[model samples]
Target chain A: MPRHAPIELEKFVPYQLSIVSNTVSEDIAREYRERFDLGTTEWRVMAVLARYDGDGLSARAVARLTAMDKVAISRALARLVANGRVLRRTHRGDKRRSVLRLSAEGWRIHDVVAPLARQHERAFLERLDADEQRALARILDKLLATDAAVR
Target chain B: MPRHAPIELEKFVPYQLSIVSNTVSEDIAREYRERFDLGTTEWRVMAVLARYDGDGLSARAVARLTAMDKVAISRALARLVANGRVLRRTHRGDKRRSVLRLSAEGWRIHDVVAPLARQHERAFLERLDADEQRALARILDKLLATDAAVR
Candidate 1:
C-alpha cells in the first residue's frame, strides 16, 4: 500500500494568499485601531464613502463590491453617519435608493489615514523589488478584473 | 480654493490584492470553521506545525510569520497541543527550544483540507489564461522578491 503523503498548506495558493493578505491587512488594521480608535470595518466604510461617485451604492452594490453583507453595511453606515465621516442622502432618481458619500472630516482623516496605509504597504511589500511590485500589480489586477473560477 | 478629490480604494494595489485574497480566504475559512471550530490563529498554527522545519519556532517566530501576537500564538499552540494535532519534541542542541511538528492525523487533515483550497485558487485564477496567469505569477513573484519600492 502506498503511504499517504503529508499536506503542506503553503502549497495551496488560496491559503498562501490569505496568509499574505491577512498578515499585511492585520498590520494596517492594528495601526489604525491604535492611532485613531477606528474599527477596521468602520475605516473601510469611510474609505469607500470617501471615493463614492454618482448617487452611490444601492446597498446591494456595496455588499457585492466590499464582500460585506448588506446588514453590516447598513449598520456601518449608521455609525458613519453619526460620526460625521459619511453622509447618507436620498437618491433623487431612485427614491428607494440612498447615496453614501464622505464628509469633509472623512476626507481629512482619509488623507492622513491613506498615506499611513501606503507607508505600511511599502513596508509590507519590502519583501519584493520594484519589478516585482509591477508583476504583483499585474497579477492582482488580472485576478480582480476577471471572473474567478474555482475548478 | 482647491477642491478635494475623493480617492478610490480600488486604485490602491494593496487594497485590490486584499479584496481578491480575502474573498477566497473567507470562503475557505468558512469551510474550516464549519467542519472544525477553528479560528484563523488555530488554523495557522496547524499549518505551521504541519510544515515544521529544523529552525523551530519559540511561539515568537510563529507570531511574526503569521502576523499573530505571541499571546495569540501561545493560546493557539496550547489548543493545538490539547487537540493532539501537534507534538512538541525537544531540540537536541537547545533545551529551550521545543520543536513543533504535526501528528499523523494532523497531516491527514491537511491533505484533506488543501484540495478545496487549491480548487478555490484555480477558480479564482481561472479568469486569466496561461499568459495572464504567467504574467500574474511573474508579477507576484517580483513583488514578493523585491518589496515594491523599485517601481
Candidate 2:
C-alpha cells in the first residue's frame, strides 16, 4: 500500500495565507489597540464608516462590506455606539432601519489611524518587489473572484 | 486643503488578503465543524500533531508552529486532552514539560480529515492558472520571510 504524503503546513497555501493574514492583522490591531483601545472588529467597523463618511451605512451593509460575521459586527457596533465613537440614526428612507456613521471623535481617530494602517500596508508590500506585488494583487483578485463564484 | 484619500477596502491588499483568508477558513471550518465537531484551533493543533506523528510536541512548540496565540493553544489542548483525542505524556529528557500527540482516535480522524483539507486547498488553488499558483507561492514565501525577519 502506498502511504499518503503528510501535509507540510509551511508549504500549504491556505495555512500560509492564514498565517500571513493574521500576522498583518495582528500588527495593525496592536497599533490601534494600544492607542485607541479598539478591537479588530471595532476598527473594521470604524474603517468602513470612515470610508462612507457622510452617507453612513446600515449594520448589514457594514457586515457585507467587511465580510465579518454579523454577530461580531453587531457587538462591535454596539460598543462603538456606546463609547461615542459611532453615531446611529434612523435611516431617512426606511424608518425601521438605522445607519451608522463615525462621530466627530471617530473621524478624528480614523484620520490618524488610517494613515498608520496604510503605512503598515506599504511597509509590508515593500518586502515584495514591484513585479511580485503586482502578481500578488492579481492572484488575490483571481482567488477571491473564484471563491465568490463557487459560493 | 487637499483631501486625503480614504482606503478603498476592496482594493486594500491587507483587507483583501483578510477577506480571502477568512472565506477559505470558514468554508473549511464548516466542513470539519459539522462532521468532526472541531473548531479551527482544535483542528490546527490536530493537523500539526498528525504531521509529527510518533514524536509528540510541546504546546509551546504547537503555538510556535501554528502561529496561534498561546492562550488559545492552551485552551484547545485542554479540550482535546479532555476529549481523549490527544494524549499528554511527560517528556523523556525534560520532566518540566509535557509533550502532546494524537491518540488512536485522533489519528483516525486525522486520516479522514487531512485528505479533505488537502482537497479543499487543491480546489481553491485550481481557480488560478499554473503561473498564478507559482507567483502566489513565491509572494507568500517572501511575505512570510519578511514578517519573520521583522519580528
Candidate 3:
C-alpha cells in the first residue's frame, strides 16, 4: 500500500528553518571571521567556554553542549589554542581528561562578540511581534525537548 | 568603552533554530538515504521537480528554489540521472539550456518519501499546541520575509 501527500518545499518547516538559520549564521559569521579571525566552529566552542566563569569543560562536555562532533571540537580547540584564545588544562587527578576554558584573550573576544551576536538576533527577531517571539521560543523549546526525548 | 551583553548559547534563537533544524534534517535524511539511496541534495532536487507536473526547470531555477549551490545541484542531478531517477531535456528553441524533471521512478520515490517527511513534521509539531503551531508558522514567515527583503 502507498500513500501520497502534497508537500511544498517552500512551506516545509525544516526547509524554511534551514534556510533562515544558514542565512543568519552566515551573516553573523562574517563579522567574527573578518575581525575576530574565527570560524563558526571556533565561535561555537568559544561560546560554550565563555559561559563558564571558572573551571573549564571537558571535550565530551563541549561536544554534548554544542552538538558538534569530537573531530570538529578538537580541530576548533587546536586553532583556538594556537591563536592563544583558548587555554587547555589537565585535571590534577585525571591525566586522561583535558579541560578547556577561554583564556583572557578568549574572554576578551567573547566579550566583544556576544553583544554583537545578540544585536543581530534582536534585529532579525524585530520582524516579529513580542507574542510571536514568545511563541517562537515556546515552539522551539517544545521541539528541542521532544527531539531529546525521541533520541 | 566597549559594551558587553551576556548571551546564553542554548537560549539563542539562531543557535536553537540551527540545532533543531539540523537534528530534524538528519533524522529525516536517514530514512531516504537508507530506503531510496538518495542524498539530501538529490532529494531536494527531486522534491522541487516533483512539484512541476509538466515543463521542467533549469538547474539555475532549482538552485534558486532549493538554496543549494550550483556544484551540489550539478552533482546531485548527475547522480539522479545516472540512477534513472531524473530525465533531462533540451528545449527545442534553446539548445543551451537544459530542463530537468523527475522520472517516473523519481515520482515514485517522492510519493514514498513525501509522506514520511510530513509525518516527521507532524510528529515534531504534535509536541506543540495549535496556537503554538500557528505562532511558529507566523514567526518563521516573518523572519523569512524579512530575510528576503534585506537580501
Candidate 4:
C-alpha cells in the first residue's frame, strides 16, 4: 500500500489496552482456574452472586449485569450448580423462573478468591501512584461512556 | 458467606477495564468480520504485517508482537495465506525458518481497514476530554510497564 503514514502498532491505544487486559486476565484466571477450577465466566457468576446477600438474582439479571448473553449465563449457571457452588432456587413471585444464590461452598470460594482478587488489584495498582490511580479511574469512566451510550 | 466486606463487582477496576476491552474488541471485530471475513487473530496478523515495509517478520516474532501463542500465530498465518492476503517465504539466511509478509491483496485490505480502526479509536476517545485522554495513555503506560518487566 502506498501509505502517507503507517499506523504505529506499538503506540495504538486499543492494542495497548487489549494487551494489558489480556495479561491481567490471564494472571487472575490462572489463580482461580487452578485452585477452584473456575473459568472466567464461572468466576464472574460467582462474584455476582457473592455480592448480593438475600434472595438471589435471576439468570436474566445475572446476564444483564455481567454483559453475557442468556445462553452463556445458562451454561455457567449449570456449571456452578453442578459444582455445588451456587443454588438455583424457585423465584419467590415468578414460579417459572429461578433465582440464583451462592451455596455454602460458593461462599467459601468467593471469600477466598475475593481477597486474592483484591491482592492482585493492589499489586497491579502499585505500579502507579495515587495521582495516577485517580487519573486512571477518571479516564476509564470517560472511555466507558461511549460503551454505555451505545448499549 | 459471612463476610467482612464483599467485593463489589461493579466497582472493581479490572472488571470495568475488561468490559471496556471486550466491548471495544467486539465493536471492531464486527466491522472486519462482516466486511473482510477476517477473524480477530487473522486481522491482527494482517495488521502486523502491514506495519512493516520490507522483508517481513518471522512467525516467532509475530507471536511475540501479537501476544498470541505460536500455534495461534501458525493458524492465523495459514488462514491468511489461504485467503491470498499473505505470503510465507523461506528465510534467506535460515532455511528452517519462514518469514511472512502481506501480499498485494493484503495491503489492499490493510489500507481499507486501517482507517476503520482509527475511526473506532477516535470515536471511542471522543467520549473523553484531552486531559482524560492523556491520563488514559499515561495509565496504560504504567500498567504495561509491569507486563513488560515480567516478560
* lDDT (Cα atoms) of all candidates against the true structure: 0.69, 0.87, 0.86, 0.84
Q: B14-109 in candidate 2: lDDT tens per residue?
A: 888988998888888899999988899999899889877667899899998888888999999999999899999999989977799899888888
lDDT order, best first, reads 2, 3, 4, 1
Give interface RMSD, every candidate, in order. 3.2, 1.5, 1.8, 1.6
Q: What is the TM-score of chain B alone in each candidate?
A: 0.77, 0.93, 0.92, 0.94
Q: What is the lDDT for B34 in model 1?
A: 84
Question: What is the C-alpha lDDT profile of model 1 across A63-131, one tens digit per residue?
Answer: 666667888888877877788877778889788887777777777887778778878877766666676
For each prediction in turn, the share of the native Cα contacts (below 8 Å between chains A and B) that it retains comes to 0.53, 0.71, 0.70, 0.62
Which is better, 2 or 3, measured by lDDT?
Answer: 2
Q: State the lDDT of candidate 3 residue by residue for A63-117, as single tens digits.
A: 8888889999999999999999998889889998888988889889998898889
Using lDDT as the yardstick, the better of models 1 and 4 is: 4
Candidates, ranked, DockQ: 2, 3, 4, 1
- TM value for model 2: 0.90
- TM-score for chain A of every candidate model? 0.80, 0.92, 0.91, 0.93
Whose lDDT is higher: candidate 1's or candidate 3's?
3
Question: Model 4: how far is B132 from its true place, Å?
Answer: 0.9
Weakest lDDT window of 10 consecutive positions for candidate 4 chain B: B1-10
List-wise, what DockQ does each model earn? 0.37, 0.68, 0.67, 0.67
Candidate 2 at A85: error in angstroms?
2.8
Alpha-carbon TM-score of each model against the true structure:
0.69, 0.90, 0.94, 0.94
DockQ of 2: 0.68
